[model samples]
Target chain A: MPAVVVGPGVASGASPVVSVRQVGFGYDGRPVLKRVSFDVGAGDFVGVVGPNGSGKSTLIDLIDGILQPQQGEVLIAGRATREYRRRDLAREVALVPQSFALDFDLSVREVVEMGAYCRARSGEVRGDAEWTLARLGIAELIERRFTELSGGERQLVVLAQALMQRAGLLLLDEPASALDVSHQLRLFDLLRDLNADGLTVICILHDLNLALHYFSKLLVLSDGELAAFGPPEEVLTPETVEAVYGVRAYMHRHAGRTYLTYSPRLRGERKGRIHVVCGGGTGAGLMRELVDAGWEVSAGVLNALDTDEEAGRELGLRMVVEAPFSPVGDETHTENVALMRTADLVILTDVPVSLGNARNVEAVCTAAREGVRVWAAEGVLAADLAGATGALVESGVELHADTAAMLAALTARDGSQRPA
Target chain B: MIRLGRTSVWPGIVLTAGVFVVCLLMSLAFGPASLPLARIWHLVTAGPVAGDLDSAIFWQIRLPRALLACLVGAELAVAGVIMQDLFLNPLTDPYVTGVSSGAALGATLGIVLHVAQFPWMTVLALAGGFATLGIVWMAARRRGRVNIFILLLAGVTVSYLASAVVTFLMIKAGDDMHAIVYWLMGSFSGRGWTEVELALLAVPLMLIPLFRTREMDILLQGEKRALELGVEVERTKRLLLVTAGVLTAIAVSVSGIIGFVGLVVPHIVRLLVGPGHRGLLPVSLLFGAAMLNVADLMSRTLLMPNEIPVGVVTTFVGAPLFVYLLRRGKA
Candidate 1:
């Protein structure tokens, strides 16, 4: 979709466009990036994501040759970055900064032409500027004043300015952070088209979802260290997200695409532990809500690949997991019972009644008989075995219609027990 | 020539050059002893005869003053553009860096020391201006890179300190008060070919910004963005600050602290041709010369023998025009 082919000559096909080797940078003795090493290969689209103050912006500056690493080196095209002159490095790498505010009245055409400041003045400079603007689908903005454009339009114009440099490697620092959703998509799409034409891009962004959706590779930074690097799916695992961001994340596949949704790990004062007897996909939501509500939740008798088992694992909960689609064997049943015996209360979700998971109900009844409070929803599982259900009823087990009603009952019971 | 909107910057530059030519001729021809246009043309054609009074006034008096005005005007305007862009503040002027105030202090000292003669005052002012620049430079340097924000604050602080000393000297000197006051008021009245030659020294420095027009334009977005875009920002900034400081020193040394032209000419040229430095720098240079020439002409002619200060005429003409431009909403 680009109007012109703007890229470096493919001569350095053997070396990565960027190489940061054991680079460590600091400001005033405060480290910003510590022993970070990564190589961005030719024609790669890389997205850099990190929490605030994780050296994402500093990393870009180092790679752009604006900041030198105190300990290690950055090599562009297998040459030491410090060796290249500023103009020569610019010809090899272009950066579209996060934001620019021009106070003077300057036309977009004039602003874009400034991108060729280091290049010798030729007639092709104007043609190149026009083509770059056209490639970004903003040819009409050439005559508009840069100060008068919307934030989205201004970012696109600035991107056009960087493209006018015709460099192979392009770095953007949160270029889409100020844009609306539609504009963000439009900007990424333009970046994609440009990348398809062999423009190597490394963008630093805060939106992890957008990073996963667009970039081929993701470099995650945490506390001034490279936390993970590789393909998005391989690198942005739930465990990595929790470790780096102190939050629980659920990876979901919907409509043939993978994405993640996050929940904050609100670690408040210690609440009493509760054991959940759930199977299939029914208890994932309940487990998350209970964890968020300051309860230490444990789940049991779940098959290894079950949705609830994955959710519990992602939440870092202690769970008794069994093999997939297998009957609750004696070992896991005893483990589930021991888990319930340690919990202050046991809650059973309305999972489908099946012979394979029939022992989960019996495990709850056994815990109740042994002097632990047991709670269950009146569902197919409770009704399947009348003898077990009758024994549970006789042992003072509380039954609610659904999760909300059951949660309300639990909240009321806690409030009565511990009044403020 | 660059195009902004539907119009090309060529027309603006051409028109300003045309106006500068007219201002040049008028400033040379019309004064207290006004020469007829035909007679002025004949004198120019005759070319600097040694013994005639009218010819002496035309060649020896009016011509050099006009040339000095044009040179100093161009220097200030170029310095203004550099300072405004370098600081990324529209309120920035050539004197904002404290160089002019330093020059004024040196000129005041020259008056007080009874060395208020032609070259002594000029030399002392240049020394004072450069010394102030060195002081501000050291204050802003951090790890070999200049911080413009810190530089601005330091310049302002130094400017106030120098101004306080100038005020004290003005209050102390009884006999030399009028001489110091007249020099401070800024007139091109008795500046002959010597001052004109001294002002001409800054002409090459003025052209330095023209070559870096593109870099100056890119710097409008700020230094970080300029660096990312591949500009040698620290080097460019060092060169530009020194250029602006030197130009300001020379201009202020020749003409004592002429205001408004340095502050307002760049803005007007920017409003006319947009802020592309390819257009902004050259157009502002020509327009600044023209505006100051006309202001100097009006100062000599408006009240005739009693002549108003050229700075007052420039402020009187410039202040209203600047406000009008601001109200037009494009600035």
Candidate 2:
């Protein structure tokens, strides 16, 4: 029988549910996890996130008593895992594996009932398999053959099996890796409900955004060591993400939930500066491309709440922002011109011309006349250019159909100017 | 919550038991000297009448042979289920690891060297079986893990080597070639009470695996998952392999390599009742017993005074049925 708890809330100073004290593990003399230590309190939904082969799965195995650490011990419920009997540990920790294929044609109920093997007597599964399957919203799959279910359905059934064990602590290894978006949300919702009912869940999530959305705490592993462990808001900061994953990430909050978006950093030395004259969501992709190619990027005359402004701010690019729904003011235009004057190249994006920001086209023409190399992106002139297209074309502005063509032109120009 | 009633396996069990009795009766009644069913039934209920040919044949020859067939069939089929479940491969059998070829080589050596006596042959066969299994294991181990594909390849290689040696020994036994060749073909002819007793020894040994059905069920989900579920995977594997090896050794000693009964009966039972060992094991035992008894009867009566080898009959019946099952399962 499972030990009954008071409720979902963990009292202050409650004993730790899981404790890893200086544990180290290796395979065939090569280390996979090194001296990892952390504590998980009761009723905590903790997510373990790391790059592939960074020892996240190995840490789960250690806590579940599947793999013993070579250097230090792992304690569950204040006792060493090695000190517990196999069935006793199983009753306390239940693991829903990533995926498992069955050779035999066993019914889903038969597979779920196997979880009760530790508690039941010989040839008997103590728990009601149907009840558990129903609780997971898979009662219809009870009599279905396990091998015939879809991947997402199989994962849900596996979760049902784990629940049948009635374990207080649940360990899931990439439970949402094979699920569709809707199914992933369903599974996380189920997990949250279970956690609300007093289950301590430690899930290894490969999707960082999903982890941020569902977990209260995050344990970040990098190169076999613990990089950070705290509330998701604290542990998933820009610096820690870059250090651990070698990528730049932005954490956004909407409706009181955190979301993470990341972009790969450029390699090698910095390229020359480029000013992008774009707005209304057209210049966001161009700005990211410039940043990734090692160029110092600046965008301007964007309305305050434009998507391009948000992308610029997220990527930390220099920008001249105007008030939303207003014409471009002289102050913003002057700021944009000053930014363009220092640039080695200026880019005109395909954003539609409107009365609110038609001065952006004039700014680009002035920059081109002043000897700044201007590259007019293909779709910009095709859209509404506010009758400034012909003058800009005659002003010695280069034309390119896409970002790839413009990048090639820039690289060729850079190569030609190296001697100077 | 929907309360889907649990499907009981009792009805299937009772139905198979009824079929088993019919097969038993059929095996008792048909032979070269065809006995009447009424007279055979009377002989079964009453003691053998003196100086009666029907009673004499039923008690001494037909009855013992059928009983031996049933016992050996149960042993081999249960061994197949254990081996298949252990490896998690559907095509595996009691002899997949070269145990039968090893037994054949041992029996041939016993015959060529004039040590073909009762207990010596059995002991030699067992020694040979374990030795072949050891060689296969050693050949398949890599970096401290047993790769099952390598093990299958090694088993095939060792089987060929053992069969070659057995053929060479038979060639050397020119005068005793008929005895060695007939034994290699595998027959239940002239088998009597002693062979039945020898086969009965495997029943308790067979129970060891039956008692481990729960662990075997977990093991069917791969070894790593079984470990996480708190099964002592290594220990369970070792115990099941040793028991299966011994069971195969015993069956080979008495029956001289009955081919395809072990391989086919379990698959047939699995198709009939689903593959939970709680149902699969008992059904395989009964179905294996009935199938082999029916095969032996056909082997004796099909040619009428010729008596083909029971192994040959089983191969002819089992191979085609296995193919049908494979295609049907795929479809």
Candidate 3:
């Protein structure tokens, strides 16, 4: 199915199979893989992470000898990698790469079988295969066509093939990227088992939480350079997270364990707002401010149940309520007039004062004439109400634009906190 | 990750042997000889003893031609397999990089000017191929290292130039057109001990060194993975390329640019056996030999009075099979 399937079972109890020393590689004279060097112990499981385009994949290729370093040499089992015979190298080292489609339609099993091609005639190919698939939890997927499988299933199958080689050293490129949460954790668990069983593994990851949880060694890559390399706790500091993510953050200790969280600053400047004569239902917004500013509020000249009337009810404001369903009918006008006379301030809403409600408008004028303060909406409706009432020419009655100005007028001293 | 599965390595082995026997019988029956089957068998068995014209014709003429077919087929097919894996391209063969064209131009130069007496025609052809590959490689390289796309481009450009040069040389050779064209077309006609002896001398020598690389599994998958496990990537690649190129050059130098066997034979055998360099290399070699042998037999018999070139016979037969394979989703 693969143009040819070589079946060589991975050698057992082999010595360290690969090594790199002071390696520096670049492209077009710009360094993509710098003079970064590290050793993968016989069964080492190293996890790599970085920002986008941070050269993690390239490091894997370089470590495996796909690309040679300009400045350093690569060795396997104490011998120069260049010197290990081909069959010998294959027997000792195996790679399980990220899954890719071929120009040909080989089955999952067929594709996996190609890994054994070098050791085609050697014994235990089936056993190795069964073990590998079982370890990856994809034993039943062997018969499924590779193209038809889900991304997670395909990843496991590919990993199974790489593991079937039973090589001492495995180079994996994001082996669990497409898997679900449990599957990703399971994949790491299997990788841990393989490492424990003495197969050196190198994997790349992006999630700091998972990387911290699963891997013992964390190689932090930034801009194709090694930012830090050590244990997760040693390398993953609050300062490091801030440096990489380019934000202000803190390492918080909760319940005796440390975690990273951010204190977000304003993203952009605030746009200011002011409200005009918002009586009746209009001044619900003003009630919101009184609540936000920790202030008390009261409004009058409503028959009952106006828009501002309901807001005042919700806010538990002290309100002068008129009679229901009727405006300036006898007793309600007397009550409103008495209330306006006692109030220190009166605001004219856009409510029209016809013959039936002429007395209500007179209360506002009377209040203004008595030097009680008054404010009006800036538009024609509020102007008409103010003119009908004969409030000040410009002295006693003030006109404001939108809600922000109206609220500011109510709570002018309180301006420190607002959304950006 | 390509997993190695249980393979029917024996089927390919059996089929290869079967093809050899059937081809030998087919060959004895062909070539204007009106002998009975029993008589043909008797005639072949009755000799190891030679001297008479009939025996000489059978042993020296036909026997060597058949053997040459086998060797050339093996050489080209194996060479194709190696080249394909090296390039990571299914469509590529040994001559995808114009190794054959370069060899053809060199051979044409050799025959036209009678330079065969000096540096040796096979040697000249090999040099021409390696030199052109070098030039193309250098041209493909820009600033420093060679990329895969650049190499492929260089191969296509060099192939075109080499074809043009060969055509010019053929025109300049004048009245010697018959010999030149026939040879260019390619055939095992009139080939006897010298051709077999020459192929035996060159092609097998290259295969011996290549066979030592039993770890070709590592080489074929990818060089880096192999190196991480302790394979010297550059050295292995160099050795493989040189060995494969030399075998291909020898086959071309002797057989006169047999096309597609290197491409088609490997693909067919790979579909049958798999990509293990061990099985792939050997199966491709044997299967290619059988394919060419059959094609050679057809060339001689199909147009008996006007012999067809073995190259023509092969392309004619191989191209359709190749198409069929692609359609079958086995390409």
The top-ranked prediction according to DockQ is 1
Mind giving the per-residue lDDT tens digits that candidate 1 earns over A123-160?
A: 45757777888888889988788888999999999998
Candidate 1: how close is chain B to the reference, as a TM-score?
Answer: 0.97
Best by lDDT: 1
In candidate 2 chain A, what residue range of length 10 has the lowest lDDT sum? Answer: A1-10
lDDT of 3 at B166: 76
Query: Which window of ten consecutive residues has the lowest lDDT sum in model 3 chain B?
Result: B1-10
Model 3, TM vs. native: 0.67
How far off is residue A253 in model 2, in Å? 3.9
lDDT (tens digit, per residue) of candidate 3 on B77-125? 8778777876778888888777777887787788787775434766677
lDDT of 3 by residue, A333-410 (tens): 566656666554555555554554556556665666677666655552443543454544434666556556656676
- What stretches of model 2 exceed 4 Å from their correct place? A1-11, A122-127, A267-269, A279-282, A292-294, A301-307, A320-338, A349-370, A377-396, A399-420, B1-6, B41-55, B134-154, B325-331
Name the regions of candidate 1 deviating beyond 4 angstroms.
A1-13, A266-272, A277-284, A298-339, A348-370, A375-394, A397-402, A405-420, B1-7, B49-53
Q: In candidate 2, how many Å is residue A268 off? A: 6.7
**Candidates 1 and 3 compared by TM-score, better number:** 1
- Sort all candidates by TM-score, best to worst: 2, 1, 3
DockQ of each: 0.59, 0.55, 0.27
Docking class of 1: medium
Collision pairs in model 2: none
Report the C-alpha lDDT of model 2 over A1-420, residue by residue, as the tens digit: 111112232336988889898999999999998888778888999999989999999999999998889999999999999998878888889999987878777889889988887667644654488888888888899888898999889999988878877888999999999889999999999999999999999999988888777888888899899888777777777777777888777776679877777767733346778999888788888788778767889989888888999989888888999998788999999999999999988999887887777888889989989999898887877787476676778777888887668877777877898899
